[model samples]
Target: MSGELLLVGSIPLDTPEDVFRTFGEPLGKYLFAMPDGEVGPRRHWISRVHYQVLAAHPELEVVQRPAPDENGVERQQPRNAADAWWFKVRDGIDRVRFGDPGWRLGYARDAVNSYFVFRTMKEKGVLPSHLRFQVSIPMVNSVLPPRIFPNRKDIDKVRPGYEAATRAEIAKIVEKIPASELAIQWDCSTELQDAYGAIAGYPLEGAIERNLIEVRNLSPHVPREVALGYHFCFGTLGGWPRFAPDDLGQAVKLANAFVAASGRPVDWIHIPVLDRSDDLFYAPLRELQPQGARVYLGAVHNMPRFEKRLATARKYLPDFGLGAYCGFGREPTSELPNILNDHLRAAQIAAL
Candidate 1:
């Protein structure tokens, strides 16, 4: 992991190359992730993407029901529930059928556009030729269907169609972008939830194995030449973890499972380190040894004395690179420079 700095997808900027320019060569020289700045709200990042896909299908319906509230009374829908739409299969159709859902989905289109942007930057000497364009796609089971289908049975019924559509999306990206120039990252938020038993619908028995099966199935489509990685995250909103992990043990176990089941050469793995800057959280890293993939600890943040956080992480996992706990897309645009500076400062410290 020497001379490496990882961007954990998305930056609070206007364009992709702006991420490189803001950080300048010192930070970008090692590694760069195409900023998903246009992704509107942070919590709704995948929700918005799901909305786009659900809207195009005539058989699916997006209806608003009462918003769940702490007290029984319905309150105004939360922002995530407000703009984000859910899916419903048409009545009389016993099963949902997908015919070329990839054409209607925009995951490949976005990745392809970002690839072109990276190529332009590299050709103009704005980015190093070694810099790879990382495309982060949410795992199919991670976000959409659970929101739309409350019952596990319903989710199971439609899961295959949705997964196939996502596989198709990956196939499209692999077909269009040169495998060498691209790196595909599977974002595993909900899978983490399932691992911790934080989310319902997933059966208690063999939940982790079932989740790994999804990764094993979806990851191989990237082709052996293309770089592949996994981002095991707890949900993030407004620059904070939705559910703080007691420890990273579950994430560590999950990473080990993914690497074992992936059956492909995983280039890297990103694990979130919450607001805590203590040895207890980093302790699990000692046991986590992903055979070939380099590990990046999401130990960087905007908190005061955050460098100590990086120091603590280095103390436990000395060879790992640094990244934010999650993407900074929902953070204030004015904070972008400071966040970028934090990364630069940490990189400098690590290089020492």
Candidate 2:
């Protein structure tokens, strides 16, 4: 409930250069710069080490990866974006199977996502008994199923099994956590950015409304008292475009419109507050009250300096939280800390 807090994307698993040197050739060139994300002994150990460092902060909380598949879908547990897109194509196909007509597999996949995260946290010893356990589902940007299954058209259309699959997943995760400790966050990568316009199977408004519907749908499935948050922003990976929603003001307006339409209450709307060049929307942002919507404007960047970055946050003033800007500052490691401090400062200044 306090504003003086630290929020971060997942820590990168350390994949040393030497480890990649053994792989040899052109492949070796790729190894030196990859992020050692959650996977394997080294990453697990890195989390442990960082956990200890973060332990003393009192205000810091680390979002860690869930356990590996018991079914063995992952190979070596890649560290970082070294292979983030490694399964992009395959995943598309996998979801398509149940995606057609009745969303036969949508709910199933959603359930698996929760279970996998719960189990992964269990294995890593990262699921702190007294911590805020945040698990992000790739709703708009990444996890959405294909637009169609040409041959059939019964239930595969809307939201896979509609909200049934999502609710089931929500229920399962809540059951795993104690009533007092339950927290779930919807990672809405594909909300209202403008780029979604270019890649259209669903209209921009339609796409957004549907996703919000999913969020509202999932809410009742979880405990009434548990905290729910929505994270949104423009994103990119490996220098390639990932997604593009509209500007901050546009997003704010759209959100207000969406909320008005849905009539649901979301505890937090976590957004990229600082670092964006567009400053056209705060008036609009300010116009919309946080009566039911508490805006966590992301101010953090991947940079390390505190004062300079925190100043950036104050400059934005009640606008954003520094987070996942261009997908967590994908190019540099030093930027993360700076970005994070900016976010914390926003929370501090925003009284949120």
Candidate 3:
């Protein structure tokens, strides 16, 4: 039987100036069953790495562009998750791939995800108290252009421009999408410490420091009902950082982690446990308890078949509404669907 579509609560929205104007309003969204209004200027920034990589490896186009980054120029890349497209690269000398203004899935997907929610509400004439979404992986700073902390006069304005642009983009989402429909899940990928420091030569402490600051800024703009959750894990980026990542145990001990108000401790953690056929991190994961929130030990890893997936989920998190995790496998093109399916299956099993 063909499986039904499962909702993935998280997706990146394509930001343009017009979209920013709608923050906290009902009628600003061009997509999503929003407050309502006229369509705003559509701005889809080109995915630089996707085009370049797609051109170089047409076969992997299905996977997505494995973006390029300067060893230390600035910006961050999307590591592990099913859809972290490469946004920029450092070392301006390379001309290895092409980028395009088209290929806009975020815009399309934003509309699609929003329509699902909005349409349902329309039919029933009911609106949800809050619109929940996974905010973009706020962890990757290396992929972005350097936003020198102090703002240097000699440096190119790329960082500041992107920073303003990003704010405006979020602002747009804020103005248009009602505060009632917003909750954020900050995916800090497991590798908040060592991996990033080693790979991009970014200071782990500084990176974590920066991330928390961003979160603090984002929190004020969000509604009180908007649940703010963090997904922490040791991430694998660029397909170069080897797979088989682990819990951010080493990193968690650092000050970067803040205990939530509830009492559990160890920073907000989410580790990929079930991969291929093994629940590698299950036993070790039990020790993780972040005070304010709960950590979901990844019950199913490496996307599983329908039967095994269900059996395994029941085995791990039978009483929770947590997500499933199957670490990246093979390549992005082929694996994302399987990963997505695992997410769908998890959602289905949860409902049952």
lDDT of 1 by residue, 262-285 (tens): 878888999988777788977888
Measured on C-alpha atoms, candidate 2 has an lDDT of 0.40
For each candidate in turn, give its C-alpha RMSD to the true structure in angstroms.
4.1, 13.5, 11.7
Which runs of model 1 end up more than 4 angstroms from their true locations? 1-3, 17-20, 23-26, 32-44, 65-84, 201-204
Best by TM-score: 1
Query: Which prediction has more favorable lDDT, 1 or 3?
Result: 1
Runs off by more than 4 Å, candidate 2: 5-8, 14-131, 145-158, 194-207, 240-246, 257-264, 302-352
Root-mean-square deviation of candidate 2:
13.5
The better candidate by TM-score, 2 or 3, is 2
- Measured by C-alpha RMSD in angstroms, how accurate is candidate 1? 4.1
lDDT of 1: 0.71
What is the clash tally of candidate 1?
0
lDDT of 2 by residue, 201-232 (tens): 55555655545565555555657566665556
